[model samples]
Target: MGVSPDTAQGLLDELFLISRALRRNLAQPEEGRLLPGGISVLVNLESAGPCRQVDLAAQIGISASAMSRHITELVADGYVLRNTDPDDGRAIRVEVSSTGHELLGRIRESRIQGLQEVMADWTQDDAERARHILHTLRSQLIARDSRNAAADHQKHSEERIDVQ
Candidate 1:
């Protein structure tokens, strides 16, 4: 007897539109070309301290080969530096370049501007309440996903057998 499913879907649709516009606005000011995935790798490297490529892939939710390709581009762009892992002779690690850190700062400011505009009409209290709700929603979603991922993966694997 609460909100209808159709109304919920309409809300989701509006959220997507807002998110897309925000992303576009965030990407517009950056002079350098770093795709979202590539910038993500930079951020991970900056925070995670030069982890092995395999571990970075898992942390970033991308395949190892795809991480390699992304690293290739990031290195070529001078936003990342890769080296042999001193502790592990067989493994490689990557770190964000000084340039990458500088760029990340700039991009972060640019990204926040769009979000600020979206909330321009809201009072400080209203913004705080919205942030709390979003954080709560995200945490709940992550918990739910962790519980369901194994079942979903197994179901996909079973479905893949029929396709093959």
Candidate 2:
């Protein structure tokens, strides 16, 4: 059954609240803690492996210049390594360094501990159900976004052809 407008709006509100809370909680800067964007870059690099900076920026929905600055800081901090792409000498590929992996592990553990404390009253089943629902919702949204992006690209291509 289709979700009612009220239900949809409620879901959106809850999602926004959750996002804001998480960001606020995580944004507390410590001596070793990364800024949110740097954390995102490290996480993506760790998950997706090495790729060009431009592609990484696109995947993370950031401007290329912003990505460059993040990468520069990460490299300077010894959290990430940048090397020339083997296939394209002019391009650079970034990969998480060993230090980055250690930092990510610590970050994950810290987040998990915080979550456990927050959900101390909840049962394991409740946590599992929340995880499953959130995962499903995220997957569906990503799929829809991919489809829309592809359609937009095709339309742009057709426009270029017509112009020519």
Candidate 3:
């Protein structure tokens, strides 16, 4: 009665690919200036302030080692600065450099311009509705994850009681 599982998956993958291609083509950023991953890290730091490597990695959905490597690259690029964490003397903190902020601002403006051009024909109401739907979808996903976690916890508790 509804869409088949395979068909649904195919549609989702196709849409993701199309969106990635559009972003790549639309954002004609300067060569060797900044990539999407670096920009993403910068934006997160800007919002969350200086963060530990592991914290940044988790927030960015990356592994701790991978985050360290990325942070190394960022530091080398002069876009990110590193310092000792005063609260955790053994750990390090990273913050976006002034250059990084400037680059992020430029990227944001460029992306906005590209999006505006792409949706030039769409009405403001349409944009607002799209934003609302996107927020709703995100919320729904968070709720689903929370429910799944609760279910898993219950199963684990049941197993422990049975063993006891």
Candidate 4:
């Protein structure tokens, strides 16, 4: 039989708790130079190279205004560089600077240290399985998002036709 609604909700709650714990442990302090939100943007840029601001915002799952504010903070902190998108002059693109890359490395190290501490009692196999499970979950989520986006686009197109 398919999973029950209660079982699915329980799994979602567990995932949310895991996300909260990671953010609590790894997020930068308010008094610190970097905000956790900005750091996340920097990390994404560091790995993804330059990306259009709107596209980056969508990928990060934040509203455009929120991403703009995070990008402004990151720019002020010298952790990222903003430039005109060569392909689309009206659009802005962002990339992590050298300083940002260094900061990202430190952030990654800190996260690894935190995970190590939390998983100290777990065996190597447990850690490996957890990593694999997370990867699978991420892939599934991405696929679901793609499907939703396509459906939304189709609905909007039909609405426009009806309007006409």
Candidate 5:
């Protein structure tokens, strides 16, 4: 059965509220320490190990130039280290520094504490279910977005050919 209009509206409203709450209430890594999107870069590098700038950009779905800007700021902040790829001297690989790892650990602890405080009233099962549902929703959204982007690109390419 399809969701009713009212149910859909409610879902949208709740999702917006959740987004705002997380953005505003979640403990920030540090005040004026890292540029916007820097945390994502650091975390990804830590998880994925040293990676070329282009690869990191593609993985994060950002332009290489934009990613480079973030990397520059991160490097200046001593959170990331950049070095020439030994296998490909033309490419630069980025890795998280020791300081970056410590910062990430602190951020993780803060977020965990914040989440625990927020979910204090929830049962263990409720917390587990919430995590599962959120992950499933995120995966579905990403897949749908990727499919839409591909279709749009194909449509644009066809339109260009048609015009020619």
Candidate 6:
């Protein structure tokens, strides 16, 4: 069964608020801390291993130029290493450096500590339940977005064929 309109609206509102709050929190600068975008790039690279710049941009939903800038800064900061793509001599692949991994560990620890403080009133079970529900919701949303993007691409391809 579909969710009620009111429930859907509530969920959207909550998500929006959560996103805003997180953005605001991340905006507060800590000494030697990476910006949110840079952190996201590092995290993605760390999890996905080495990837081409364009592929990383697409995966992170950012422009290639923006990804290049992030990579440049990261490389300068010694947080990532850029190497020639073995399979494609002309292309470059980026991977998290040892320093990057160390930074990520620190970042994770800080975030966990912050979350622990925020959730201090909640029981362990409450945190686990919330995590499970949020993870499922995130997976469903990604799958739905992938399906929609595929359908749109197919429609555009058919339209181009009809025109030709």
Could you list the CA RMSD of all candidates, in the order they appear? 4.2, 2.0, 3.4, 2.2, 2.6, 2.3
Q: Taking the tens digit of each residue's C-alpha lDDT, what string does model 1 give over 21-138?
A: 7666667455446655777788788889877888888877799899889889888888888888899887778888888788888888877886788778999999999889879967
Comparison by lDDT, 3 against 6, better one: 6
Tens-digit lDDT track for model 4 on 121-155? 99999999988998998899999999999999999
Off by over 4 Å in 5: 4-6, 29-31, 149-164
* Segments in model 6 whose C-alpha atoms lie over 4 Å from true places: 23-36
Q: Candidate 1: worst 10 consecutive residues by lDDT? A: 27-36
Q: Which structure among the candidates has the greatest TM-score?
A: 2
| Cα error of candidate 3 at position 136, Å | 1.5
Superposed by TM-score, candidate 1 places the C-alpha of residue 132 at a distance from the truth, in angstroms, of: 1.4
- Give the per-residue Cα lDDT of candidate 6 at 145: 88
Q: Write the per-residue lDDT of candidate 3 for residues 12-69, one digit (tens) a residue.
A: 8976896787667665455246545666777788887898888888766777877777
Model 1: runs farther than 4 Å from truth? 1-4, 150-164
Please, what is the TM-score per model? 0.77, 0.89, 0.78, 0.87, 0.82, 0.87
| Total backbone clashes of candidate 6, pairs 3 or more residues apart or in separate chains | 0
Model 5 C-alpha RMSD to native: 2.6
- In the predicted model 1, the residue pairs found to clash are none
Off by over 4 Å in 2: 26-33
Q: Clashes in model 5: which pairs?
A: none
Would you list the C-alpha lDDT of every candidate in the order shown?
0.81, 0.87, 0.80, 0.84, 0.86, 0.86
